[model samples]
Target: MVGDAHRAPETAAGRLGRRLLTGWAVLGFVYLFIPIAVIVGYSFNDPAGKFNIIWRRFTFDNWAHAFERGPLTEAMVRSLQIAGIAAIAATVLGGLVALALARYRFRGGALIEILLVLPLTTPEIVLGASLLSLFIDLDQQRGFWTIVIAHVLFCTSFVALTIKARIRGFDWTLEDAAMDLGAPPWRTFSRVTLPLIMPGILAAALLSFALSIDDFIITFFNAGTTETFPLRIFGASRNEISPQINVLATVVLLASVALLLAGVAARARVEGRPVVVLTDTDG
Candidate 1:
């Protein structure tokens, strides 16, 4: 009777702790997503004033005329182009670094890895200022190429780290097997290694693209007179906040969500696993 009484109280306390933790987790998610929900909700709102802050009514006009904002559209296109180029460059360089680090025991390996991670750990504002200063010292023009360089500098570290993580536990015997089957080095790499690592590379590319597109502080210092989408939006907010901004933002959000779902599906398929849907399965 005494043991039973003690166990009952302990069990109750554990359940209470779990419930509290669950509640906190739910609250955290809600807090994080509230601003995003607001952005999505206001995308459909039609405001009368220059500022799109006040909700006037619901309208589809913003969606229909999303790209009608000439400067905004141009800026978005410019940002996309820059992001694409930067992602490609960063992925190539970073993938090489990751491969080298993962496959080899080289001198200064730890130092190199630390150097790669330093950019990620450093403050973006400091990176931006430093890059700006470097360009100034070098007499380099702070424009498209400079923006690309700065983006690649930051993104390379992330890509290298992500790909390295994915490839860490990889089996090298597969590559050896391919070579043993009379395949040349390049052939073995292409047929065996590349396919296995492609998912990580793709993930890194997508991440780099997203980061490049969303980057503001670094671009701000290095962009010179060139206005990317983020810069344009920041400038526009001061003078005239457009509903088109919200529309574009909503579109990007939807696209990102779609991509995330696609990635999840792809991963599930690759792992030969069924996706677990959350629902009431009980009768």
Candidate 2:
């Protein structure tokens, strides 16, 4: 009965409209996935000349030697490290900020909300320029830690907003009840508040990691003499575009998808919701 459509005798016009909407949805999905399809397809292709775009022959060599390029591999590893650290740092800080905003009335709460929105609305170029200037004023070297710090700066807003949306209208009475049952504050939080909010936190962490890994502009401005995966790809493109890029990208794409799906399944299990939302009705 959940998500059931209002079924009735349909006219030809109604049928035509439904068909049009379904076709439009299909078209949108195709448009979004076609580039990803091309990327996955190209990973198997051997370059005809300097171009990996040409489909000359298929081979497994690119997948086999995905980490063959030293600079690319190092850059990718660095990017992963930075993303992981930034994600954890952002998630913890953002979770606390979101909890504070959601759970308590405090001074400057509205101002804090506005400030959180500013980073998301601000242009990447402006953020990068401002951060670069700040770093120069502090005389801090732009490297791994700087990149991680910059990522955390931009990513915190995303994490906070995401978790805030998730925890909106959440029942805090459960936490209070647990505390009333003689649980310590830490225990109540770890057992009740944490489990309730963990899904949102995980989602935010994954999102922050993805954004940090994919970021080019902020990383580019802040990364002095260091190359992230995106930076490496851009640099390599100036020389030659390799199939290995596509291969590694496909791996990342699949891994991210897998993680998301796993999280969804786990959450569904924890919440006792249906694993699959869509259902078929029989006449």
Candidate 3:
């Protein structure tokens, strides 16, 4: 009877703890999603006031006239252009670095790896301030190019690290075999090696693009006359908040999600598997 009584209490305690944990998990997700939900919900709001924070009424006008905000649209276009250019530059440079580090062992390899990692570990504000100072010292004007440079500087490190991780376990023997089969280096790389590593490259490119687009601090320091979408939104929020901001933000979020899904689908198609392979053999 004593043992049964003790067991009953222990079972009750376990259930109570589990219920508490489940409640906390639910709350955590709600906390994380509440702001996003607000943003998405406000996109359809037809607000009488300039600020769209308050719920007025639901309308599809904002969605229909998404580009009605002149400066906002222009800024969004500029941000996209900058992100594309910066991501391409960063990916090209970083991919080369990743290939070298993954495929070759040489002097200064450890030092190079450490240097590559240093930028990632460094605080963003410090990096932004240093870059600002460097531009001043070099007599370079802060503008579109400056923002692009700043983006590439930070994005390159991430691209390198991600691609390196992706290709670390790659088999060089395949490349050797292709070469032995009378395929020139470029041909072999394009046909065999490139196809194999394309997924990693694409992932890194996407990451770099997203970072460049979302970057605030570095862009803020470097963007003198140039205005990006985020910068425009920040400026507008102080004076007048528009539902168009929410519309654009929601559109961007949707676009990003679509791209991510497309990437997953493409990877699945290419690999003939539901999930991507991290190593040679699937377990």
Candidate 4:
């Protein structure tokens, strides 16, 4: 009875600690989200030839202007194109690297993994400068293609990491079983392994796309004449903060949020959860 009495206070203390942690976590989330919320809110403000939020009224004219024929729209299209290509290329390369890492044990495997992840750990400015130097040395044009290549360089690491995590948790027995059933290695991989890891691949693709689309510094270094959406935004902020830019920002923000939610929903569905009804309310 004395021991139980002593344990009660300890348990209560643990619960209290957890509650405090939860509260702090909630506050942290709010801190992160509030700024984004404010930005989105301000994106709808009307342009009175001024960038100040206090002097503006709410309007959708900025969004219309952003979408209309302009340099901003052109830059946005260029950005999307570059990002799409980069995401696809990075995902493919990363998938292959993840497969090799997961399935093979060779000499200097650890070294190879480290090398693959080097771009991610290295400072972006250094990497960007190095890429620019290489392009210059090779006498290559610094344009959309260069930006795409730069994006792929870092985005591939994220893809590999995501797919590798998924691959680690996978059952190799399924692959072996497929092989035993007289399926060829390629067939087994395509039918068995690919299906199992599709969710990870999709997640990696989304992550890569987001990274490529949002990248500024590296793209800035590599992009000579070809300007991306973020690059345009940066330039615009220097001259004059246009309401049109806010519209573009809001659109991108909404798209990112929607894509993120969709990815989560897809993952849940793939994992055999009913996304429509998350919990049972019955006692």
TM-score of every prediction relative to native: 0.90, 0.89, 0.89, 0.86
- How many clashes in each structure? 0, 0, 0, 0
Q: Please provide, for model 2 over 42-134, each residue's C-alpha lDDT reduced to its tens digit, 9 standing for 90 to 100.
A: 999999876687899989999989878588888999999999999999999998999999988789999999999999999998999999999
Which is the winner by TM-score between candidate 1 and candidate 2?
1
lDDT of 4 at 160: 88
Ranking by TM-score: 1, 3, 2, 4
Q: Is candidate 2 or candidate 4 better by TM-score?
A: 2
Clashing pairs in 4: none
Alpha-carbon runs more than 4 Å astray in model 2: 1-11, 273-283
lDDT of all predictions, in order shown?
0.90, 0.88, 0.89, 0.82
Candidate closer to the true structure by lDDT (higher is better), 2 or 4: 2
lDDT digits (tens) for residues 92-152 of candidate 1: 9999999999988789999999999899989999999999999899998889999999999
Predicted candidate 3 versus true structure: per-residue lDDT over 7-54, tens digit per residue:
645578898999999999999999999999999999999998898988
Q: Which candidate is the best by lDDT?
A: 1
How many clashes (backbone atoms < 3 Å, residues ≥3 apart in a chain or on different chains) does model 2 have? 0
Poorest 10 consecutive residues by lDDT, candidate 4: 274-283
